[model samples]
Target chain A: MIDLRELYQEVILDHNRQPRNFRVPEHPQRQAEGYNPLCGDKITVYVHVDQGQIRDVSFKGAGCAISQASASLMTEAVLGKSLAEARSLFEGFHHLLTDEGSGPSTGGDLGKLEVFSGVREYPMRVKCATLAWHTLKSALEDESATVSTESPNPTPSGGP
Target chain B: MVKTEATLVAPSLDPGLLRPDFPALDQKIHGHPLVYLDNAATTQKPTAVLRALDRYYRRDCSNVHRGVHTLSQRSTASYESARGIVQRFLGSSSDREIVFVRGATEGINLVARSFLGPRLEPGDEVLVTAMEHHANIVPWQLVCKAAGARLRVLPMDDRGELRLEELGKVLTERTRLLAAVHVSNALGTVNPVEELVAAARQRGVPVLLDGAQAVPHKAVNVEALGCDFYVFSGHKAFGPTGIGVLWGRREHLETMEPYQGGGDMIVTVGFEGSTFREPPARFEAGTPNIAGAIGLGAALEYLEELGLPQIEAYEAELLSYATQRIGSLPGIRLIGTARRKAGVLSFVVEGVHPHDVGTILDQRGVAVRVGHHCAQPVMAHFGVPATVRASFAFYNTRFEVDALEQGLREVKEIFGP
Candidate 1:
C-alpha cells in the first residue's frame, strides 16, 4: 500500500500552496479549458510559443492538491522547452503516473515530475494528477473545444 | 456552543448490537477498520436482506405474473408481497399505488413522462426546490423542455433550508406540479413537505416528494405527507439496487399513461394496439427485478423490526454527536447547518479542497463522498466547487466519527499552514 506521505510530498504541497505561473499569460496564443466531471476539477492551460519554443506556460484552476500542484510543476517544467519536447515530457509524466512498472528512476528526464509516481498507487487520483498535462496538450494543439476527462475517445484534444 | 459529549437523549436501539447485522461493516481497508460514512450514496446490506436474495435465487427462482409452475407461483407471490410491503411502508391504501421502478431516478422519470408530461401546457411551470438531487431536477427539465413548459426553482437560504415564505409567490396559476426533495442528499436539510403539500393542495396543484434521502433515516408515510407521489430508491434503505418504490395517489396512477411498452404490463395484445393493465402493473413494463423486490421487502422488514422511530431517534443523537465534534475543529466549516436535518454532514476544511480531504480520509479507512454529489447547483449555491460529505447510517457509531475526526486532522497536518 502506498503511504499518504508518498503522494502528498513536501514538494507537491509547496507547489500547491504557491502554484508557479498560476495565471493566464498576457495575450496567450494557445489556450484550452479542461474539466473532470467526476470531481468537478476545472483547469485552463495557457501557452505562448515563440519560434517553435514555449515562451511561457501557465495555468489557473480549482481542484485537489494533486491537480493544482501538477499544473504548477508542469508550467515550470515546460516553460522553455520546444513544443515536441513538452509533448514528450507529458508522455513521460503520463507513463510515470499510469504505468505501475515505471518508477521514478525509470521516468527518463522527468526530474521533479517523478514525485507523482505515488499517484499511480491511487488509481482514482491518476486523473487528478494528469488533468493539467492533458489541458496543456490541448492548449498546445490549439483545440477550440473544451476537453473533458470523460470523453470516450480522447485524441489530441482529449482530456485527462 | 458545541457539546463535547454525546447528547443526553438515549438511542432507542444500541448501534453496537445492530452493527453485527451488517457483514460489510466488519472488515478493514488499508489495515485500518473500515469506517463507512457514505450512507447517502448507498448503504451496506444486512444479513436478512442478503439471505432473502440468496434464498430467492437458490430455491424460488422464476419469472412472475406469467409462470404457472410451482416455482413461478412462489416467485410471483414473493414479488407481489414485496409490493404490499412497500405499500404498507409508504402507508398507501393499496398495493396498486406502489410501482417498482429501477430506482428513484426512474421513478421520477416515470412521473415526469407519464403524469406531468402530458398535462403540461406551453407556459405551464413545474416548481422544484433548489436543493433537489439532479434525479428530481433533470427529469422535470426534460419533460418541460419537450412540452414547451417552464421549470421554476424554489430557492433555499444559506442554511440550506428552502425559502418557504416564497412558496406562495412561486406557486402561480401556471404551475402545473410541485416536485421537491423530502431530505437533501448534499445538505441534510429536511424540507417541510407537509406545509409544501398543503400549500400546493390549496392551489389544486399536485406534489411529488423525492424521498431517496428521506426513507433511510426516518419513517416516511406518503399519505400523512399528503404528497401526490413519493419516490425512493431501495438501495439507500439497506435493500438491493435496481429496485425502488414510486408511490402515487390512486387517482393519479389510474389516469397516467404507462412510461414503457413491454411484457407483463398489458392485459391483451392486438395488431394495432394493446390494452394496458391497472396502476402499478401499467408502470412496471418489463420482467421486473423479482429477486431485487424480495430483497428490498426483507430490508424494509428489517428496518421495520428495528423500528424507524427508534432508528430515527438513534440517528438524531448520532448526528448531533457528529455535528458537535466535527464542528468544533478549527479550520473546519460545516456547509449544511439546517435546524432540522437527517443522516448527512457536509463540510469543507479551510484551505483544503474536498477531494484532498476525501483522499486522506480514505487512506485512513474513513470512507466519505467528496464532489458535487450530483448536486452541482447546491455546490454553486454554497460558492464551493465541491464538499466532503460524511453521511451516517443507524449502524454507524461514535468510534467511527472519531476515526473521521482523526483522519481530518491528519489532512490538516499534511497540508500544513
Candidate 2:
C-alpha cells in the first residue's frame, strides 16, 4: 500500500469524496465535455461567466481519485476569480506538474494538493491529477463547447 | 471432469512453483502478488527462454551460414535447424517456406512491400478488416497508396467480430489481396480465417493473416488454414524478441522480390549488377538475427512438449471464469464479449478511469494493458474510447482471476459503489 498518509492525504481524498460545487447550476450558460481518451476519463466542466469574471464554476464526470479530486478542488480555487487570474492559476499549476522552473511561491508544496506531488514521481499519473485543470482551461477559453476529459494527447505513435 | 486436489494428484503447477518461473512476479508491488494480465502487450520470458538466450551468447557465438570454422558450421547448422523447426511448426510443406524477420511488425511490412507491393496495379483493391492491429492495416495502406491500388476496409459488427457477411460483398475480381487477423488483439475476437481464405481463393485473391495474437494462444496449422501468407511474432509466444516468421507458399516466395538487400542475400556483387540467392535465403538479406531465430525455434519445441491443445483448454477455462466473475461485478462493462473469442477481457468501470483502475490494480500487483491497444478504429467502433484489457496466457490460474475480481472490488470501493 502506498502510504495513504503520503499519497491520498485526507485533504485530497476529502475533496474527492465530497467535491466542492459538484452539481450543475440550475441555470448554466456554457458547458463543455472534456475527455482524456487515453484512459477513458471524462469530465463535463460547466462554466457560468458573467461580465468579466468566471462567477460560477462546477464539474460533473467520471474519473480517477486524482482527477475527480483535482477537478473538485479547481472549481473551489477559481471561483470569483477573473478570467485572466484563472489562466494565471493554470500556468502555476502546469509548472508544478511539468516540474518546470517557474513553480508557485509554495514551491513543490501543492497545499491541500500537496498529496498529488508524489504523482510527479509517476509521470503517468501526473495526467490523472491534471486532467481536470486542462478541461477547465478549455471550458474557460475555447468556444469549442464540448471538451474531452480523455487523457491528454501522448506523443502520437505516428507523428502527424 | 473437473480436476480436484486429490484427483489432480501432483497438483501440477503450484503457488510457489509458477512464481519461480517468472522472476519479476516474485517482487512485490504495493504489497501484493504481481498478477500479469498484460500478456497481449508482451509476455515475460520464462527461465527456458532466458537460458536459451544466455547459452547462445556464452557458448555458440558466431555469424551463421558463412563460417568455415567448426563454431561457424555449428552455428549455421543450428540456425538452419531452427528454420526447419519453424517450418514444421507451421506445417509448411518445405523449410524454404519460412522467412525470418525482426518481429510481426517487420513481417507485415515485408509482405506489404515485397509480395503485395510489387504485384498490386492501379485500381486493384486490397481488403483489410476493421479489427486488424494497426500493424496489419497501416503497412497495407502504404502499399495501396504507393501502388495506386485502393484500400477497402471490411467493417466489424457491434460485438467487434469481423463482419463476415459484408466480406463476401467486397471480394471482387478486383480484390487482388485479402488481409485480416486470425485473432483480434484489441477485441479478443477469434476470426474464422479458414472460411475467409476459402472464399478469397475462389476469387483468385491471395490472403495474408495477421496471426500474431492467435499463434500464441491456440494451435495453428498454416496448411489447415490454407492462407497464402501467415505471420507471427516469437516474443508474443514466450520467445525472444527481434524474431518473427513470415511463411509463404513456395510459388509466392519465388515471385516475391527481396524486401532488403545487403550481405547474405546476394550470391555475387559485380560493380554493375548483383545476383540474389534463392527463396528464403534471398528474402533474408544482411546478417540475419541468428540468436532470435534459435530462441524462437526453442520456444516452439517447448510449446510442442507442453501440447498446444492442453494450453488452449486450460486458457479457455480461465477465460470463461474471469469473464463470468467480471460480468457479475456491478457497474463493470466488458467491451468485446464475442461468442467466439480468445482469453482477453477488456472492460471499463462506470465511475473510474482506466488509469485509476490500472493504478489501483498496480497497487494490488495486477498488471493489465490500458490503451487504445493500437486499434483506434475498434475503439471508435465501440464509441466509449479506450479500455483496460486483461489478456491472459496459459500460465495464469483461477486464483489470479479471483485476485482480479478482488482488485475490481477495491476499485469500486475507492471510486465508491
Candidate 3:
C-alpha cells in the first residue's frame, strides 16, 4: 500500500517541479484567474479557441504541488479537446475529488485526471488540486476577463 | 512577601531530556523526522497531562459539588485543586477570580457579554488592535452594537506591531475598553502590555489582553501588567482542549451577571424568580470539564517543574536562529519584523503562494500553519489574503529549523531562483 504521508506521488511532484506550458500565451483568446485565498493557492488560466476545437492552452501562477501539477496535467488533457469535452472533464474531476461518485472510470473518460482520486482523502488539499480546473472553467464560460489571486468571487462574463 | 519567579532562579531545561515527556514527538512524518512547529496554534500535551486525562475519567469520574459519594468528593477536590493551581500560575488574587470557559474565544465573549454589557453606553468606543484574532474582534462587535458603542482600531506598522501613537489618539474620554493580543499569533510580535495598560489606565479605560499566545511562552502576572482582563486556552499551554481560563478583577466578576442559567451555577432557583450564584459560579453554568480541568492543572505543574523562564530563554535562542536562517533565503520575504516576538514566522516566497510553501514544507515533514490563521484583518492590512506561518514551541530545536530551511530551498530550486 502507498504510504499515506506520500499522498502526492513522485510523478505528481515531478510534474510540479517541471510544470508543462507554465506561461501566459504569446497571444491568448481568453484569460481567467482562480484563487483559493484560504490556502493562498492562486493560478491564471489562459485559453485559445478556434471554432469548436481548443487551439492552445497555458497557465501561470504559484500554489501547492497538487495545484501546480494538476494545472500541468490539465493542460495536457484539455489541449486537443472541444470546449464541451473540457467542461465534461472538469465536472468529472470535481466529482472524483469530492468523492461524490463511484469513481468515474468507465463513464466519463477523465483521462489522466483519474490519477487524482487519492486527493479525496485529504479534503484540505482538494482545493489545492482543483484551483486550476476552476480557472479553466472561467475561461471556458467566455465571461471573466482577468483572474485574481486574492478573491474567490467567480468572474463575470467577458461581455459588457 | 514578593512572589518568587519560577524561571529566575531555575536552571535551563534540556529539550532532549524533556523530549520523552510528549508522546507525539516520537512519531515520523513524510518519511522524515517529525518536526512539529505549529505550537502557537496549540501544543501537544505532555505525558503527565495525558495521564491526568485518563486517571480522572477512569478512576475518579463523577459529578462535582452535588454528590456526597466518594467518587464525587474526590473528583470535586481534584477539580477545585486544579483551579487553585491555575490561579497561582496566572498570579490571580484568588481562585474565585478564575473561571474556566471553552477557550480564549469564549473567555473574551463572556467578558464582552457579562461585564461590558451593563456599563457600555451609546457612542462609547471600544478600542481593539488591528492584529486581533476573529475571536477577539467579533465579540466586541456584538457588545458595541448592543450598547450603541463604536469600535475603533489601534493600527500597526508593516511588522504587525500595534501603533501606540494611534492607540493614544484612539483612547479618549469616550473610550470604554482596549482589547488586544499580548502576542500576535500570525506575526509573533509581543506587545508591551505594561505600556499598553498604563496608557489605558491613564484615561481610566479598562484593557483586556488576549493572552492566548503569551501564556505558553513567558511569565504573565495580571497585577504586574495592571490589565483588567487576561485570557488563554489550555491546549495552547500543553493541556487538553475544551477548557480555558478567564481571569478578571474581583469587582468586575462580582458586578457582572451570570452568563448561563443551569445547575451548579445557581445558589437558589425559585418558581417566582431565579436567584443566581455569586461571582465565578454565576459565570460558569453547567457540568464543567472535570478531567480537562485536572489535565490543565497537571499541565501547569509540568511547566512549573520544567521552569517557564528556562523555556523562555531556550525558545528565544531558537527564534533568533530560525529568523536568521529564514531571512537569508533567496526570494523569501519575512512579513513581521517586530523588535520582540514569540516563535512565529509569517512569510511568502516571491512567485510562490503561501499554500504552495506550506505544501512544500509538509513534504519535508515540517508542520506549520498556513493561511489567514483566523486573523483576516492582519492579512488585509498586509494587502495579501494569507501567509505561510511556522510557529515554534519550547520543544522545537535548531534541527527542525534547518529542516524547514532545506524544504524552502528545495521549493526555490524547483519553482525558480
- Candidate 1 error regions (>4 Å): A152-160, B1-11
User: Estimated TM-score per prediction?
Assistant: 0.97, 0.84, 0.84
| Every prediction: chain A TM-score | 0.92, 0.81, 0.84
Ranking by lDDT: 1, 3, 2
TM-score of 1: 0.97
Which candidate gets the maximum DockQ versus the true structure? 1
Better of 1 and 2 by DockQ: 1
- For model 3, the stretches where C-alpha displacement exceeds 4 angstroms are A1-37, A40-87, A95-107, A111-122, A131-160, B1-10
**lDDT against true structure, model 3:** 0.83
Tell me what TM-score chain B of candidate 3 gets against the true chain B. Answer: 0.96
Instruction: Answer with 1 or 3, whichever has the higher DockQ.
Output: 1
Which candidate's TM-score is highest? 1
Runs with alpha carbons beyond 4 Å of true place in candidate 2: A4-105, A108-115, A131-160, B1-19
lDDT of 3 by residue, B199-253 (tens): 9999998999999998898888898989999999999999999999999999888
RMSD of each: 2.9, 5.0, 6.1
Q: Model 1 misses residue A68 by how many Å? A: 0.2
The candidate, 2 or 3, that scores higher on lDDT is 3
Which residue pairs collide in model 3, if any?
A33-A147, A143-A157, A143-A158
| C-alpha lDDT score of every prediction, in listed order | 0.90, 0.80, 0.83
